[model samples]
Target chain A: MILKSAEAKPHIVVIGAGAIGSFYGAILKRAGCAVSVVLRSDYETVKASGFRFTSPLGDLSWTPDHVYQPGETPLQTPDYVLLCVKVLPGVDRAELVRSWLGNHTALVLIENGLDIERELADAFPDNPLLSCLAFIAVSRTGPGTVNHQAYGQLVMGNFPKGFDQHCEQLANLFREGGIDVNGTDAVVGERWRKCVWNTSFNPLSVLANGADTLTMLDAPGGEALIRLMMKEVIAVAEADGYPMPPDIIEKNISGTRAMGAYKNSMALDYLNDRPIELEAIVGNIVAIADRLDVPVPHLRTVLVTLRIRQGVDSAHSE
Target chain B: MILKSAEAKPHIVVIGAGAIGSFYGAILKRAGCAVSVVLRSDYETVKASGFRFTSPLGDLSWTPDHVYQPGETPLQTPDYVLLCVKVLPGVDRAELVRSWLGNHTALVLIENGLDIERELADAFPDNPLLSCLAFIAVSRTGPGTVNHQAYGQLVMGNFPKGFDQHCEQLANLFREGGIDVNGTDAVVGERWRKCVWNTSFNPLSVLANGADTLTMLDAPGGEALIRLMMKEVIAVAEADGYPMPPDIIEKNISGTRAMGAYKNSMALDYLNDRPIELEAIVGNIVAIADRLDVPVPHLRTVLVTLRIRQGVDSAHSE
Candidate 1:
């Protein structure tokens, strides 16, 4: 479904005002869009001082045109609703943004993992559902504070395929705000590319008990295990009709090696006793593999370990 | 070399008097053998009050005929030296028992893991070396106390091949002491059989953060992961010419399920921050698989996770 562009200065609503949501919303606002933010944990702080972002794309302080606490409706209809929450289990994402979604408001999910757009697409049949992948190193350091370590390019497309007029307009707005954006027709394939790295490093970091990228790669038999897991992912992808480039595994390994001692976010989540996106990141791939009858023993083993740990962790908390 | 039976009462010396050593030494003494134990940490307490055993075989308290500290030589040359220490990476097992071995003494290793007899075989070229596997559930509750939960069967054979008269002599001694004994010529195959269980549960328990058998088996994808790892072990064993029985994996799973909530030894070692037997158990299997050109991606993946965790854990302690 190709979506048409809205008026010149469109109103943008940010559903989750965390790192990715806050960063991209501020970028759109810099292009003269009227931005409103919805926040819970950092509502008071953001309402008081707004957000301070430190990024290579140019540091800036962004105060939303309007701020609304969760469960409160915005006064103006939004042109776009950016969903940037972590894709964790037990969160009904479609219901989270139902109140703010207007008739023409295109839902853009600038998040991780695959098949994340299905629920929202099912909920709002007429709305343009844009699935996005944010290739950026950003984290929320403190209340209303964001730190962008590296890269800030976004790849986005319509629900299942094709770039539309609205996607082009959004890209132009991001370019005007000094951030690079790519409108791709094959954004789902791009997700598989990203998963080549995510599936190997994310759970491995936690399993290593909070090891960094290099620590995982440098340990005995670490590189081989990572390669085996990456091959499993590739097999699943290929069997699902998205064969990756021959050099993708090598590129991911060398790329992670260059990142030095960066701890993947899932490891940080596990260390901080927070819920992780185990289901979205690795579980879906294994599920697909099971359907395809493509054996993915390596990924399945790691997935089970993460599941047990997550289960036991939540059980203890309860 | 075949070993003839000793005089009416054989002189047996036990080294590394932890759980296995203590239990077996007490049993030998019950059969009227003159047993002497070498102690380290529990020397004073054991010398003062001896050991107390609680087992289905029978409950009894027995003091050793002689108790010598480490580095002290017993007055009489032992007919058999029992080595029951943990097969960790460091603390050379051969060197630890070097001072206790004599010209006529046979070294019996009642330990867990594979390829564990090679070092002792090299160290004592002329002396008899018997490799034995203890299928028992026992733990040292206190300095000089042991709690045996179930099963006290010993599988023994001469190292690297055929059983000799000493195997028969030792089996008779164990039988007289009210313990079950199986003296097989195919002990290496038996080691592989034991590994079908150890390679899966031991490392997996630690990976689950000290979870017991039921917790591991009950979690989603847990049993499948265990089965995958067990299959890999079987593959390696078959490639190396010791194919397991068809029902080995099922037998192991059901046996563990009936054990209630049992934490494996490696998991307990991890919980207590002691060194694990990762090398002797899973590492050697992977090494053999590598040499045999048999792919064991599941075992290799789990092996690297355990290695990194063990390495990171030791580093943090240092």
Candidate 2:
């Protein structure tokens, strides 16, 4: 049931509340906003005990105001619905958010990959779509438990351009929860920048048989391979009219080295037999490169190998 | 002990007698040569029952005249010593062959990969170094038992260039044993031609998680990936002064499709945890491409991923 109040407070609904969503939703809740969650696997545990977060930002036990399973009707109208699910195969993001889209609800997608906003934008042309990039080291330790190991900075903006009041409001709410948030006019550019890392390490980690970032980086020619892929991605970005900064590759490499031994999200998914985000992360980037007549052999090679793996795996299952 | 013969025959010592060496050594023995083998893992089985072959070229069970273990001294080292071991990480081909190099024994290398002869050539400057490439589908089903499925052709020549009497004599002997053998003056060029297929498929099969030929070809974008890798290899070949035939890519693709669900040797090695010839196959190709400043990102990508797998596997063992 919707909570009745003398005055309506800003309400946020978190879709796909695994780790990123649950953590961010808790932060918004701490900022005095009413936060709800849509969950699948962790629905029972989270509904019973709420969320126990052991984080460097200080441990917190947050209980979402409302816990809703997927396929349920929209119980309350939300001012913002945070789409935080992985963009994997069979995940129709636009369809997932369609039923929950109220007239004034602005959808914010805090996910990985390039060219992710087009589907939602096409489905709801009038609704404001904000895209976000999360640079955080967080993982779900168990059901309803999240462990945040490192940085949690977020950059978000309006879909095709300029920042709006909705973006500003969300950024302020996130900041109030004690994490850094940047509301930029160039969110797409920021995505390309982040993709320079994602498109390389994510697929490489899986391809290397669940190797950690440092294992890959320390292997002979591993660093060069990463550098070449990043260069190809930067070329694709440049061709797509979003040229990255001059030192982006060095910055990315050094940043990854500083992160120590860490397995990327896709690698973890692969090891756990969960579907990886190949299309959204690498495939779309390769497609853009192909359309722009840019040569991205490294990216294409990774895409092809990963696709072959998926095909072989499905064939075995069949 | 040397076999006492009233009439002396060509004494052929076969080193690294796994599958390819065993089959070819059997064929040579069938051609009325005194064929001996150097075996490690299969020595007992081979010494007891010899080899049982099942091939469309006509099955034959032929016993070796002698089976010598590793570290044994030179035993009647004669006209030829065929080295057929895999060029894996720990294999020292030069050291393995050094003790058996008789003064008159011409060393014939029936192995895969380019630049493989340099180590032997550097070691035995006085003896004739003949390099041969085998295009065959052969596997050891059990110890001392080989199943030769298809095409057993041999291409042999002198190290630098020019066909000699030794090459012609070996070719004739192979032809007598019911297989085609081409003695070429441009054997290096022929190697580059064969590498167009090896460099593309071998590492790719492993990277695709032990995918067979048809599985890889039929996967979405798989054929395109192979074609791209083939083109890069061709580019490297051309840069290295060996321009391949115009239809090499198409011919290779079609020939592979006709092979029907074959897993390359490297893929089989990977699946069985046997040491793969990554350095000899994809690594050398990339090295040549890098030296020539050729853009072989596809090949380089495959090399990098495989190297990472090697690193990760070794780390786990440690």
Candidate 3:
């Protein structure tokens, strides 16, 4: 059902108030969608003084029309719940968001990492499930403040079918909000393409111990390593029948190089003494490669050290 | 040809009085050989108080017969010049001890890493380079003080031919000092065997940013990575016609596991801001593998990052 105007505007409940969640939710709200973001520690501060969005284009300040925790919101069932929480290990994501998941509420995961949809899909199969790959350069510099540094493109697709009417409607909502959304049936391919950069550089940035991207690229064999790792990712993706572009390696490298002196999310978390999203990022690649009998030696070697750094001795274990 | 009496005792000059040099030189002095150690910053304190040897068996303190700077040492041509300095990039190993090299002076290298003797042998062909792989656990905890930890075994073998009377004589000299030194006809084999541990754990320890052995091993996939890297080393060694034992993997693992908790030399140097030995330890293995057309991907992967950490983009160059 293509809802239009006033009553037709779908309400989106942003599940996590981090950078992506806040920025996107604010954008959606500004674009006439009923956007409600769950405010945690900054509930009072953000609720009272509102929040700030510092982007290249301009700055915006607005109080959210609806602000409440899960189950505290006045709406019985939000049209959609956009999850932006980090898919790290030991997070009982299903349980944490149980209160917000109404019977028919569609769940859109605007998160990073691979193979993340299975659990939630299994738990709430009836509700529509969408996997979103965020290609935005955004950061939560301070409490309730999001700094949109660079890109803000989001690629999404509905589960199993990859694309459906719901996916189109959601993509339309995002496009109207000025998000530059891309709807694709090849969600897996899109993810693998993004992983080309994430797998190559995220943990490496962590290993660099908060060294920015430029400094990391400055390391001898470092830039070449990025290309090699990206090529490796491409190989695995091709093996899994989700082939990406021939020049994907160059494209990813140039893209990251253009990011210019940015510290990746993994490095930022590492520097702040918080756990990075290990399972969703590198571990899934290793797992999938093992399942396919593909030799991913470079990924294995780097992942082993990365796991050790994260104090995780074993990966993909229950 | 082993001399027994003091009148026929061979004079030895020990260069680089760090842990390995100080401990071994002191042991030679204790065994009645005329030993003169070239001192650096530790010169004055060691010269004033002599030196203290704190071994597991017992502690011994003694003043040296002669201690001086490298160029100021009295002996023009000592029987042996023990080189224990790190073979890192930019260090002129030959030129550092050019003044000590005499026509008949046998140069003994009690150091870590692989293929280290090739250059020195090329530089001074007639010096009879004796490569001693120190399996002993000893460290210079402070100036003029050495701590003898777990193992105290030295494997000495003559280069090129490996087995010679000089090797056996050096073994005997160490034996008289209560050191358990073994002479082998397989110097390359011994170095490769030690490289099993060094290549696997050394760079990793550095990458861990000075995390000690146990801490490193305790990390997830840490032990498995050690085995994998060791297997890769063995493959390269076997291809190069230096076939190590089939059970070398198990032996190396058990032996390192038995070391309990100790930081490898690379980690120690990294923590102290001193340059870690990259060329000799990892770079040599990589070079030999490349020469032999053997793929040692794991070692290559680790070495690339390790080189960056050591501030070396490349090795063995001006």
lDDT of 2 by residue, A47-155 (tens): 9999999988886679988899888867788889999999877888888888777988999999999998898899888888999999888889999999988888999
* TM-score, structure 3 vs. true: 0.92
Best by DockQ: 2
Fraction of native contacts, model 1 = 0.66
Better of 1 and 2 by lDDT: 2
Model 1: residues >4 Å from true position, as ranges? Answer: A1-8, A54-59, B1-7, B52-59
The chain A TM-scores for the candidates, taken one by one, are 0.95, 0.94, 0.89
Clashing pairs in 2: none
Better of 1 and 3 by TM-score: 1
Candidate 3 chain B lowest-lDDT run of ten: B309-318
Report the C-alpha lDDT of model 3 over B136-215, residue by residue, as the tens digit: 77877788888888677898888865677777777888898887987888888888888888888888777666666776
Best by lDDT: 2
Which model is ahead, 2 or 3, in terms of TM-score?
Answer: 2
iRMSD for each candidate structure, in the order shown: 1.1, 0.8, 3.8
Candidates sorted on lDDT, descending: 2, 1, 3
Candidate 1 on A16-72: residue-level lDDT in tens?
Answer: 989889999888878878889999899999999999999877866799978898799
Q: Model 3: which docking level applies?
A: acceptable
TM-score of 1: 0.93
Q: Which parts of model 3 have CA positions greater than 4 angstroms off?
A: A1-8, A70-74, A214-218, A257-261, A312-318, B1-7, B73-76, B210-220, B258-262, B312-318
CA deviation > 4 Å runs, candidate 2: A1-8, B1-6, B57-59
Candidate 2 chain A least-lDDT 10 residues: A1-10
